[model samples]
Target chain A: MSLAERMLKIDRRIIFLVIGLCTLLPLLYPVGLPIRISSEVRGVYDHMESLPERSVFLLSIDFDPASKPELHPQAIALLRHAFRKDLRVIAMTLWVSGTGMAEQLVTQVAKEMGKEYGKDYAFLGWSPGGQAVIINMGQDLYSAFPSDYGGKPTKDLPVLDGVRNLKDVAYMVSLGAGRPGVEEWYVFGKDKYKFELGGGCTGVMAPGLYPLLRSGQINGLIGGLRGAAEYESLIGQKGKAVAGMDAQSATHLAIIVLVIICNVFYLSLQRAARTQRQIG
Target chain B: MDATILGAWVATGLTLLIFSFLYKDNPLFKLAEHLYVGVSVGYTIVKAYDTVIVHLVIKPIIENGEFALLIPVAIGMLMLTRYVPKAAWMSRYAFAFIVGMGAGLAIPRTISSFILKQIEDTVRPVLSLAGPDGVTFSMNRLSIAGLGKGWHEPASSFS
Candidate 1:
């Protein structure tokens, strides 16, 4: 068979093998490639840095296990930044399916940072109603979440001292994967309540939030695993997101090489066909 | 082995099973897919019952002497009427009340947030060369130039 024909007929299994090797090798070994931090990501870091100690920082975990790889790192990096800065954190999830994961993540991070629950931080767990929950929180934080994730009354929690409602929050960030997420926070939680807002979303959902960012409704945005890596670097802590970047870069390079090879063979075959036709 | 370690092993096995679909769809892939959906739905139901019934309803009514919550409790119970066949028509009352109240609560906030606030932000001056104090042309120029440079770097790199 002609070279071009053979190229077109190349087994997809071979391509899959190359992708697997490209991803697996970088992850198993270590190659720390320098990542360029985007301004959107820097915006979140800068805003967090500017908050004074003990300022209220609300973190909404709006993703589930399906998006855990991308959104989990964002949550961890943000938690680290908040704890490191001595900001009071209130973590909650809008998704019921994500509640267990969110609670576990917050607890894990709090333990890592030696943070005291109901004193330095609180987790509100899951509540029924999506937008209604945000609206309720805006009206009266205590009413929205009467009890902490652990079944203690939130009103009595020292962590929530002097914080009455959404308006009292110094800044809020939503790490979201789908609907009833960042958009809901803006519409129900921030715009009406008038608190500063930021967002982190899976890459596919990132572009939709740019208009809000541009309008200052969302002060910053972190998009996908790259965004998580950028935040991790900013905080001077290299975690899973940073480790995954090398694999991503390697796989991207492999795909580019495949495209180049395919194009080269196609062009050569076209030229040979033309020559044969001319001679005939 | 520790329960945590066993759980980790199970998770890893399931992850690999799911990933095997890259070769081609097979029993392992189907099994993992079914397991994920089943676990997720089961977890969601348990959590909802805990959060909605125990925390929001029964606990408040019993522990806090919040008797007023019975109104919502009654309304919520009305939703189950649909399963009763002959009494299924009664469910409309609950649906109507819910939809009506939801719209009532959402409309004004939606208008302000998605429409008016957006307009207010968009109507601002594009280039403010002059501040309240005076025209600081050099500062404005430097600011604009910096923005331009920052915008170009990422676009050029991507291309």
Candidate 2:
């Protein structure tokens, strides 16, 4: 068979295997490549930096497990930043599946940083009425999220003493995946209530948010695994996002190389076929 | 020690077993995929009931005696009308309530987020250097400078 024919007929399983190996190998041993920090990420970091100590910030984990490989790292990186800065954080999840995972992550990171829950941070678990809850927060904070993730009244939490509405919030970062994510926050919270807003989103949804970032609707954006890596870099704490970047880079480059090789093989075969036809 | 390591080994084995289907279709992947779906759906239902019924409905009535919740309770029941084709129009109240609330929730945010914010960020200049007085500033300032502290002259003017 001609080289082009052979290339065209290569098994899809081989391609899958190649892609898997390309992604897996770098994850096992990372290259520590220097990452360019986008302003979208720096915006959130800068916003947090600019906040006074103990500023009330809402860190919303509006994502689920399917997005864990992307959004989980963002949650961790942001939580780590908030804790490091001694910012009073209120963690919550709009996604049901994310509640347990987000809680586990926050607890682990908080412990690592010696953070106390009710005193330093509080996690107000999932709420069903999404945007209604956000709007209700504008009118009455306790009515919106009456209880913390553990079922303690948010009204009585020492950390939330004076925090009554979005106006009381210094800045809000919504680490999100889909509907009721950054968009919901900007509209419900930042629009009418007028709170500073930012977000971190999965790769697939990142492009849609660029216009928002450009407009300053959101102060910053941490996009996909790359955003998480950049945020991790800023905090000077390497974690899963950084590891995943190596994998991402390797996989992207592998796909490019495969495309190039296939094209070259195709062109060579075409030239050979033309020569044979001319002679015949 | 052996048991813990063995458990890890078993986990690794199951992972590989499930992943092997990427090379080709297999019963193991099917079983795992079905179990995952089942568990996920169960979790979602329980969560929904806890939040929607228990918290929003049951708790409200029990704690506050806010019988006004029946409006939402009726709307919630209307959602079941979807299963009966003849009575599907009865579901419109539920749809309208949900969609209306969604729109009420979405429209204002859309205006603030997309409309107002777009104008603010776009019409704003990128050359205000009052924010950073350093000799050099990041290129972000060069592109969309909005009221910064440091640079007096526009970078465009310098070039």
Candidate 3:
């Protein structure tokens, strides 16, 4: 077979194996490539920075496990930053499947930071109503969440003292994967309540959220794994997001190289076919 | 083994099974895919029952005497009529309630959230007519010029 034909017919599994190796190797032995902090992400960090100590920061965990890789790190990074700032955090999830993961993450991070529950933080857990939940919380916080995840009355939680509704939250950031997430919070929570809102999402959803970011609906945006890496860099605490970036970069590079090689092979084959036809 | 370790092993095994599809179609990949769908559906059903039936309906009506909640509960029960062909017409009440409520909440907000707000941002003068000092240009809130202090700008083609 001609070189072009041979290359074209090469087993796809080989390419898959190469891509897999590229990802695996980087994850095992990281390059620690310098990650540039995007302004959208910095928007969240800076807003968190600008908040006064003990200011109430609401983090709506609006993603499920399907998006865990991209957004879980974001949840962790944001929680870490919030705890570092001594910001009082109240977490809830619009996604039912995400409740357990979000609760565990917050608890784990809070424990690492030596933060007390119901005093330093509170997790309200998941509820059924999507946007209705947001509007309900805005109207009557306790009515929406009669009891927190641990089944404690929200009315009596020291963390929620003097917090009447969404209006009282100093800042709110929804780290979301899909619907009933960042956009719902903006339309139903922030737009009506008028609280300062920020957003974080998987990279795929980041571009869609830029308009919201630019329009000031969300004060900042943290997008995808790279955005998670940026937040980790901003906090000066390297974690899973930082580690994952190396794998992402290596995989992206491998794909790019493959694309170039494939194009060259295709063109060469076309040219060779034309020349052969002319001679014949 | 404890749930955590057990979960880890199951997850790892499933992950490998799914990855096996990278080579070619096989029973291992099919098993993992089916398990994923089953688990997802099961989890969603349990969650719904926990939140809707136990917490919202049962706890309120039985425990707190919030009987007014039954109105919505009745509507929800009507939705179950969907499975009974003859009684399916009763489901209209549920659909109507949902449509009416969803539209009420969504229409004006959709216009403002997706349409009007987008138009405003798109057309808003990024470079304001020159003021006394100079042209008051607005950088993206994430931009270095706009972000101001703490953390340098992230270098990305998009940014």
Candidate 4:
């Protein structure tokens, strides 16, 4: 076979290995890539920064463990920023599978800030109905969730003192994966309740939400791991998202190079075939 | 060792088992795949029972003397009739109620949020529009500074 044909027929496993090495090597040995903060991510940070002390900030965690890596860091960075600003934060999940992770994550961040549970924040855990739950909360917070995740009465909690319903919330953000997530939150929660809302979604869903953001229905969007990294940078605290940027950069470059090489070899193989047929 | 640390080790091992499939499909990969799905489903069921059955229904009836809640509970239970071949027709009532309530709640919002507003944004002039981020920029003055943005630089550094 001609060299061009041989290159064209290279083993699929070799390509996998090339991409794998591209990701794994940079992760193990850190080569910190300078990450530019996009305005979409900065919009989230700036809004949180503008909130006054004790202002109500509700976060809806609308993703399961399947989306943990991408959405979790975004949650952490946002939570840290909220607590740092002394915002009274209330977190809940519309996705049942996300309840345990959301509980643990909010608790961990709250503890790091040395913020008291009832006073500084409340974890409302997961409720069954997706849209109905938001509508119920819009009317009466106590009716939707009588108690926090730990089963403490929410009405009595200092963190939710003035928060009778979704309308009471000053600013809210939904860090979500799919359906019954950012879209549901907007349609059922923000559209009706009139609360200022923001969104952080898996990279795939981010593009879909840009329209809502443009309409000012949502204040901002944090998209996928890259968005998470940008928020971390804004907070001046680099976490797992920042750590993964090197790997992300390397992987993207390797894929681009592989694409170029494949095209060049493909063209050469076609040329060789035409020349051989003509000579014969 | 701490329970948290033990959990971390278990998670790491399972992750590695999942990644092993990239080399070749094996029994180990299959095991991890099934385990992940099984665990997630099992957890979902247990949580559903707690949130829906216990908190929403049982606790309200017992604590607040809200026996009226049983009406909706009965509607929900009618879905189980699908298991009986003869009584399967009864399940439609449950489906009807759910579909009706859902539509009543969703249609208006869908129109306002998706269709009408989307048209507004679509027709809105480019210069007049502000990005969702509130950072307004026009195509005319779009500057492409920091051209490379280190995308090509990182991989080269490792090499």
**Evaluation by DockQ, superior candidate among 3 and 4:** 3
Model 3, A1-280: lDDT tens digits are: 9887888888999999999999899899989999998888898999899999999999999998899999999999999999999999999999988888889999999999999999999999988789999999999988889889887888889999889999999999998899998999988887777899999999999988888888777889999999999999999998999999999999999999989988999999999889999999
Q: Please name the candidate that would achieve the greatest lDDT relative to the true structure.
A: 1
Clashing pairs in 3: A36-B154, A37-B154, A39-B142
Write down the lDDT of every candidate, Cα atoms only.
Answer: 0.88, 0.83, 0.87, 0.87
DockQ of 4: 0.32
DockQ per candidate, 2 decimals: 0.35, 0.37, 0.33, 0.32
Q: Candidate 3, A149: how far from true, in Å? A: 1.4
DockQ of 2: 0.37
lDDT of 4 by residue, B42-129 (tens): 9999999988899889999999989999999999889999999999999999999999999988987887678655655555454233
Clashing pairs in 1: none
Task: Give per-residue CA lDDT, model 3, range B117-146, as digits (tens).
Answer: 676556446523322222211212222233
B-chain TM-score of model 2: 0.66
Error of 4 at B124 (Å): 4.1
Candidates ranked by TM-score: 3, 4, 1, 2
Interface RMSD of each: 7.8, 7.1, 5.7, 10.2
Candidate 1, B109-140: lDDT as tens digits: 67666665565455445434333322111211
lDDT of 1: 0.88
